[model samples]
Structure formats: structure tokens, C-alpha cells
Target: MYGARLQRSTCTNCNAAYTRRYLKVQRRVTPAVALHSRARQRAARRGLPFDLDVSDVIVPSICPALGVPLVVGEMRSPYSPSLDCIRPALGYVRGNTRVISDQANHLKGVLDIEGLIKRAVASVDQRREDYARLAAYLDRELLLADVRRKAALAGAAGEEWAEVAKFLDAAFVRADWKR
Candidate 1:
């Protein structure tokens, strides 16, 4: 009975020590790699495809959506790497899943593609209105300049001469300033 107890104690302690050593080694990896490894393990357990290697794709350390450097941390933290699903409620497929910054992932969660499109279209419309106003102003200025030039060339009097002289002075001044 004593021999059997001793043997069991040695075996269990060795096994526990080995498990602890393995976990310690895993903990030494970077947070981004560790999180990705955990996701791959989960995908394997769920019978999903996860063939991509994190080392191959994440060399630059930049977030794809935000276009900034990656800050390794746990899930849902700003600048931290997080796994994103291309289509909501779908299993993790090889091509459909990607790692992105947590901030971008959270932003995407609140706004669908359609909502983003609507916002972009509205912004473009407002910009177009501003551009229309600018173009109208330029057109009127060009017409006035042309009239002044014509009147000056035809030897017209005081106000027309002054207008043409001012316009020419402005044009020459701008040209000199560029140089």
C-alpha cells in the first residue's frame, strides 16, 4: 500500500510539473500571437477552417481598418488585435476571418455597411454643394476679369482702367509669389 501511494505521488507531480512548464512557455509569446493561437484552437475544436498563419500576415504590426500601429492587448481594448468575422453569425472560415484593431471592430459592430454608405453619400453631397458655390464664384470672377481686360484694351476710362490694372496686378503678383 505504501509503495503504490509513493508511485502515484511521483507520477502525478511529474505530470503537473510538465503541464505548468508548457503553460509558462506559451505565456512568453506576445499577446497578439497568444490570442490568435487561442482563436485557432477554438476554431479547431468547433471543426472550422483556420489555415492562415499569424506570423505570415502580421509582419507590419498595423491595423488594417484604422491604418495605425498595433498595440497588443486583450479583446475589446483600443489598438489591440481582435478577430473579426466578415459575415455576422457565420462559422470561422479560412478566408472570412481576419485580425483587426479592437477599435475598428467595435466601430464596425455599431455601423453596418449600408449605414456607412449612407453617411458617405451624404458627406459627398454636402461637398458637392460647396464645390458648386466655389465654381460659381470663380465663373463670376473670370467674367468680370474678362470684361475689365476688354475695356482696358479698347482704351476705356478711369474705373475700367483701374479694374484692369488691379486684375493684372493681382495675376502678376500671384505668379511672382508662386516662384
Candidate 2:
């Protein structure tokens, strides 16, 4: 007669159970990873050909435009890697895309090198105009004060100084200020 029903579990069964649990845990993806996957899927659905895998995309720690650190989020942060096409119409081709911040992408705006240079030159010209205007104003104000002082000194002196003052007034006239 069987004494007590012998109860035993095989090492193989226990090991298989442990392996399945571990594999299941490992398969779980983080939100960032999920977002990236969704992006790829969306791109594919749009009929655009994307050869690069999500694993290959490197998320930068900093926003290149704003010069601030990037935080992981569903919409903008994870999706912040705005794929830039160097040629502007390359259509998501590999090697043409570089990751940049959304703000940078917006600022870049149409990506015509000539247009960008023209904008930069215009900005520089405006700054120079402002600086020149201020300099001219200061120069005129200071020179006018100096000219008034010289006139007062000439008026207080004698006839001999009157000839000197005449010369001084001529010089002031040449300087383009009131004597």
C-alpha cells in the first residue's frame, strides 16, 4: 500500500516557471520606449518609408535651441526629437535625419541657407544703426557744451583776446557747432 502520496515537483518545471516570469518582466517597455514605437508606427502609417529602428535613435539630454536639459514626457519630450531632413525634402531617409529640439526646428523654418544669412545680416545692420545713432548724439551734445564754455571765456577777455576769440569762433564754425 502506498504510504502517503509522494508529492514532488521537478527541477525542470520549477526552472521553466521562473524563466517565463523573468521573460515576461523583461518584455515590459517604459513609456518613453512606447512613445518611440508609436512614432515609428505612425510614420509607417503615413506611407513614409522609415528604415531606422527606434533603438538606433539617440535622444539628446539637452534641447539644442533653448539650451536646456530635456525631460522625458509623452508628447513633446519623447517626441521632442524632431527629425530634421538636411536636404529639406529627403522624406525621412536614413542619414538625412538629425535630432533637434522642437524650438530649433521652428526657428530653422524652411531651411534656406541664403534666407537665413540675409536675416542675420539685417539684424546686424539694425544693431549697428542703433549704436551709431547713440554715438552721434553723445558726440554732438558733448561738443556743444565744450563750444559754449570756449565762447564764454572769449567774451570775458580783453580786445587782444578778441582776435583770439575770432579765430576760436572760426574753428568752432569749422567744427559744425554753435560758437
Cα lDDT tens digits for candidate 2, 1-179: 11222231455655666665544343242433543555467567767656666554555555433333445443454325554443444445444344545554555555455544444455565444433332333233334434544555644554445555456434422333221
Residue 144, candidate 1: alpha-carbon lDDT:
45
Candidate 1 global lDDT: 0.51
Backbone clashes for every candidate come to 0, 0
What local lDDT does model 2 show for residue 117?
47
After superposition on all C-alphas, the RMSD of every candidate to the true structure, in Å, is 22.0, 27.2
lDDT of 1 by residue, 1-179 (tens): 22224445568876666666565455344654665677688777877666656652342266544454566533335777767654434545443454656665665553444544444455565443433332332333345445554655644475677676567534422322110
Candidate 1 similarity to native, TM-score: 0.40
User: What's the true lDDT of residue 24 in model 2?
Assistant: 39
